[model samples]
Target: MTDATLTQTGREPRSAGALIGRRLLRWGLYALLCLFALYYLLPLFVMLTTSLKSLEEIRTGSLVALPREVTFDAWGKAWSGACTGIQCEGLRPFFWNSVMMAVPGVLLSTLIGALNGYIFAQWRFRGANLFFAFLLFGCFIPFQVVLLPMARMLGIFGLAGTIPGLIFVHTIYGLGFTTLFFRNYYVTIPHELVRAAKIDGAGFFRIFWSIFLPLSLPIAVVTIIWQFTQIWNDFLFGVSFSSAGSQPITVALNNIVNSTTGVKEYNVDMAAAIIAGLPTLFVYIVAGKYFIRGLTAGSVKG
Candidate 1:
């Protein structure tokens, strides 16, 4: 056989060894990742299994064991039959309340943030940096710090304990973050677009609506996901700002979990917890990739 042919046909021992080593390393990394995934998912697994089990089975069987007989009675009870405090209407109303609060809050905050971001990025005015810095500072302020002033404002506006009040609270609190995200994203956009739009007789809103808004989808997704997650999962504001009738799911979940009037139905609690968490989880599962893309899109320029 020719030397070239022999070299090609017979793999080098060192190369073969390296190939085996690489395969082993890759498999090892995969196994490690799977292990970590399972570890992180353990709670969710437990919750699902427990929710499917009857209360009797939950007590008799292992905490992580699969249900002996799967049933969604707990889910049904959690959705509409269970009590949240004095109300026997389950988490249904509170879930809808959160939806109402979060939807409007996310929209209003994102819209206002887009406008603020446009202004800061394209039309720099006096004290722009100072004002931007203040907004950034507001992002880090503790929720407790603003509770008193916000409560007072809500009272004055006759918005206290209402869904709109909660919406207003979330919008105000989330503005700083939404503004930061959109501003950073907008600054990466070509300034010439704005300048050219102005030279062509486009006004502030006109340029924004025509040029910037179209390109803002990525950042808008990021901002929406962020603001929605914050507003949906917010217990502090939900508990503080809302009354019994207007309380968000988080508050209702707390009430259900802590209710002392009846049997400690572990299955029901698990189901309710899952129900409360489903929205944010679903949002991430559906749009998580876009979030990463959006974050990186702005990161290059600012």
Candidate 2:
């Protein structure tokens, strides 16, 4: 009885020690996570503060300070009265153009990506893996490397300096990432779902639309938000693909912020930057739940 009791006592202390160690580990993880959160949020805080400040105050005070005179004039200027060219058209036109470009680009690209991903995930044809391998390869190539060829191709196709051209460009670029995202996601789904659908005489398009699409809500949100943000905030592609009248907000913002002879208005530039970012920001905020859901669904399922 004494030996048995001693053994019981030894196990109890070991279990208690492990509990304490786990608590310490959890606390350490939370502390590190808090630090990382602060690191990421600092830049956004600075941007917000700077946007509120007047031009003179911004130059005088530290970037971290609250504006002494908070004014919406910068936002007003950014929205309707600031000059980008000889015209004082503000960011409104470019903003509209960006919306037009992003909406169609996101929709088309996400649709194509979902279709491609579903096929890759469900169907196993000869050379399908090889084709997907090529798609993955496309993702690694830099946009800049393809710019010249893309430009020449657009010019040849009579799509140069047009909205459709920009949309097409964004869609093509988006295909790699979107396809990969959906493909990875669809792989985690049970094969029995597809098999059952097939047994009921569901064809590819019918199964995809009726069954697979409904289950794809989480990833669809992610794809839309990603493609929307990328196309909306794109500068290099906008500048390269379109002329002055056809350019997106980023190009206009660049022109506004980088005039060779004009006096730079850092405050307005900050405001314009915020405005340019707002749509994507709004997209993320609205779709935040689905994004989290999508990521969790992938991880938890795997």
Candidate 3:
């Protein structure tokens, strides 16, 4: 079009070149993203293929090849029949152990943290910052640093080499982070609510139950998801605190996968790994929206 018509329409032939370049750049970014996605996803593809393949196919074929014949045999074995040690029974019990450990661990930790966060965020006691700082201090200390002390304490409590010991360890370790999450999230809550509750003769638990707890749902979800995943996947605490029968899924999975015996069951190992991971994956998928909201809530400007 002529310059007059171009000006009238807010269009230019020269601008078409710029538009084409923009399109090319956008496509280039998309291509880069796709490449990265494939790079990260390649292992999952391999694991699925390997899990479905027979031992012979895995040994003879490419690692990334589609299974010659799909089989649920490995999945079944991984779930109910694979040997972790002298025990030929599969991951079922250990999975339950994880469930048992994770459920109470998440609940108790999050509950105490919610209370602690309320005390830290809303209750302005003297030395509160110092106490909160002490709590934060726990988060920085590595588990290995406290491992000996924790082990000794568990032993003293007669909880060593038991599932409860693992639960206790996870709850204590997790309290630091969960408290932090709720504290930061609660900081964003307006003080007017707390003041109004006090004026209405509400006590600490009353204010928390009535005014804060409902508002804390987003952060509670984040805390539960975080604690659940961490406790479920923890290998160190499980290995140190749990014996053969009491071991969590992680330790059991290790024993099963690394059992130096007659045959290396790659298919079974892959299937077991998937089974071990499914809970955390499912949690992330289901509550992921609340997770994002919880993370962003603390950062919002009043």
Whole-model lDDT per candidate: 0.89, 0.86, 0.89
Candidate closer to the true structure by lDDT (higher is better), 2 or 3: 3
User: What is the per-residue lDDT of model 1 for residues 183-271, given as tens digits with 9 covering 90 to 100?
Assistant: 98888888888888889999999999998888888899999999999999999999999987899999999998888475799999999
Measured against the true structure, the TM-scores of the candidates, in listed sequence, are: 0.91, 0.85, 0.93
lDDT for predicted candidate 1 compared with the true structure:
0.89
Question: Which regions of candidate 3 deviate over 4 angstroms?
Answer: 1-14, 298-302
Per-residue lDDT tens digits of candidate 3, residues 82-174?
988789899999999999899999999999999999889888899999999999998898777888899899999999988888889999999
lDDT of 1 at 160: 98
Candidate 2: give the clashing pairs.
none
Q: Estimate candidate 3's alpha-carbon lDDT, on a 0 to 1 scale.
A: 0.89
Q: List the residue pairs that clash in candidate 3.
A: none
Better of 1 and 3 by TM-score: 3
Residue 227 of model 2 has an lDDT of: 89
- Worst 10-residue lDDT window for candidate 2 reads 1-10
The number of clashing residue pairs in each candidate reads 0, 0, 0
